[model samples]
Target: MRRIRVAAAQMGPIQKAETREQVVARMIALMDDAAGKGADFIVYPELALTTFFPRWYHADRAEADHWFEAQMPGPQTQPLFDRAREHGMAMSFGYAELTPDGHHFNTSILVDKSGAIIGKYRKIHLPGHDEYDEERAFQHLEKRYFEPGDLGFPVWRMLGGIFGMCICNDRRWPETYRVMGLQGVEMVVLGFNTPSVNSQKGEEGIEQRMFHHRLSLQAGAYQNATWVVAVAKAGSEDGHHLMGGTMIVDPDGFIVAQLGHEDDGVLVHDCDLDATRFGKETIFDFARHRRIAHYGLITGRVGAEPPPEE
Candidate 1:
């Protein structure tokens, strides 16, 4: 039985005034709780070490860089790693990354039980605009602060299954899951910080926002026949409300575990990795069912164009 106990470590608001050390300490406390619950793996939300800074626009580069880490497991994050190693717990978490070359990316890293970095995935589908719009309630300047991720969707063999990682907006893209699905992924872990209100969809309500989040995750899990562990950085941050519906979905797309509160909490569940086999080999079998030849537009076309000649 390839069973692994996992936890969706949902975080509450990280106040704008909070420091990285304070946030890491809070994460460690959540890790302690997950460990006590016998969880083998814990998934944390995107930008785990800071508030959702992208909600506000920063004119100065130095101000924006403050939210980014110069190195993985850097000084502020090393304690979390140390604690994970001590407890023999594997973890996946997200953060803003600043490369040595000064480029920045929204990144997530997977750490094995031994506290070794096993895989890393940078967020590819960046949402929002670069320029700030005064008419909007708040700014989502991710495009201005982060460069498009250079790393493609990749899967790694870890914790007795094929694991893949994606961050925030990447969860909304079908291509993100399909790439990993094609790689035979058995599980996909993701972190998100979605606001309850979006400027692009100003008329939409919070119910719709949460519904879309779950819909995307459920669809991705069922289509790929993979377990999905999605964590959220939710609640109001400096008066800005964010949605929190952290959940764990089975290979059949049913939510087996979910957090009910918009606060710091953990939802633990024992997931059987082998549960994916039945679906993979039957109705959803990619090898036997997928018609790649008919998907030429997905692979070849860049923008809207005419259909292929008959």
Candidate 2:
């Protein structure tokens, strides 16, 4: 049946004072928990190693750089790899990546059951502005700290299926899934760190934000005919409240498993990859139903003149 038992490893907030060791220990505990539940794979949230730091503006580059990791399996993160190896579990997680060239990006990586790195994806659609504005409740300076991802949407063949990865803000965009969908992706793993309140839309309610989050994930899963594992790092972190709505969506747009806690928890589901065949071969068979010629405007030109009236 090509079934995979997946776990949405939703994490509680990481306090600003917490060390990397403490965070990694929390992740390992979750890994062990998932393994005990017979989960073959686990998905962790964005910036899983530390607090969401973009909320505060940093004038010094070094101070900001401290939040990023220079290497994936560096000393601080090696234990995660070891835990995955010990459990023979495949996993995906997000982190702040600092390149040797002095560039930084919001990155996520996939690891095989053997704990070998499968592939990586840098977040393309970075949210928030680079400059801080005094009018907002809190700063969301993602653009200020990380460069736009250079790596395009890529998919990999692993665990008896095609897999793809995306980060927090990337999940809100349809193009993020469509690109991987074109590659015949069977599963998509995404992690997010979303605030309960929108600083830009101050009047927006939390219910609306949660709706949008689930709507995007369901839409992406159903439209692409792929299973989606979306995890969250939520709750109050350093007094800032974030949303917690971790879930696993089936190819039919149904949320099979979900988390209802604002604390560290794991939600496991046995997902049948074969279930995607029906949608892909019938309703969402892109190769048979897609018309690309008319889509030139999507990439060719922006704000082009409209067609003349009849």
Candidate 3:
């Protein structure tokens, strides 16, 4: 069976004021760390370029623009590409994207060892409020600031295997993995910035939130029989606490590598992509087990729980 080495880079808070150069430098350092350990691929947290700005109350367009990156290989982040190319390593990082047509999105990019941009995935699941709710302590205005991800979940041929990507909230949905699984994806990369508490519920939310995080990843990996590499940009940012549980899950629903803290850290795992076959053939074999019909949830149109009536 063949294997691939992967690194899940867990990083602490990044100040919104931090320049692109600073963020890129941080990413390069992680890349170097992974490369030194002979990792073939590195995965960084969602919005790895800047602080979690969706938490703040912002009315100014300019300020919002300041926090968004216009072009990926543009001036500020070119060094990241140059460095990865020089090291002959592949990487995936998440960021806020300002599209050429004036659309703003939460997005992630995949770069090959040659530094060529292989694929881009816009986050599909936009969480939080569309309108300001001053009653809450903090804001999760992702829906208010950014447009819903236009590009549906997609899989690509990369790094000698089938690859796919998803953002924080997207990873929570089973369909996110199913989309890629249909393509016979061998590996999935995801980045997250999950908060420590649910704004409405409070501390009881912690266990459930953390459970959902691991649950989705584990279930997704096991169901799809694909390697799951999940990284986090965790810790307190803007006076709000966040959760950090970076982990690498094998196709068999087992955690191969994990990091406990929400800080600057790297967890490396020697992944056998071929190991996916063991689960795929035995447990998650779609051709042998998946029932496409009789499950009314998938093809339903309204997405509103099917009217609650049989």
Model 1 C-alpha lDDT per residue in residues 85-180, reported as the tens digit of each score: 999999999999999998899999999999999999989999998887888778888998898999899999988899999998888888888899
Question: For each predicted model, how many residue pairs clash, with residues at least 3 apart or on different chains?
Answer: 0, 0, 0
TM-scores for every candidate against the unseen true structure: 0.97, 0.97, 0.95
- Candidate 3 wrong stretches, greater than 4 Å: 60-62, 305-310
Q: Identify the leading candidate in terms of lDDT.
A: 2
Candidate 1 vs candidate 3: the TM-score winner is 1
What are the Cα lDDT values of the candidates? 0.92, 0.93, 0.87
Worst 10-residue lDDT window, candidate 2: 297-306
Worst 10 residues of 3 by lDDT: 301-310
Q: What would the per-residue lDDT of candidate 2 be over residues 1-310, giving only the tens digit for each residue?
A: 9999999999999999999999999999999999999999999999999999999897785688889999989998999999999999999999999999998999999999999998999989999988878888888999999888998999999889999999988888888899999999999999999999999788775799999999999999999999999999999999999999999999999999898998999999999999999999998999999999888877788567889999
lDDT tens readout by residue for model 3, 122-151: 998899987779877678989877888888
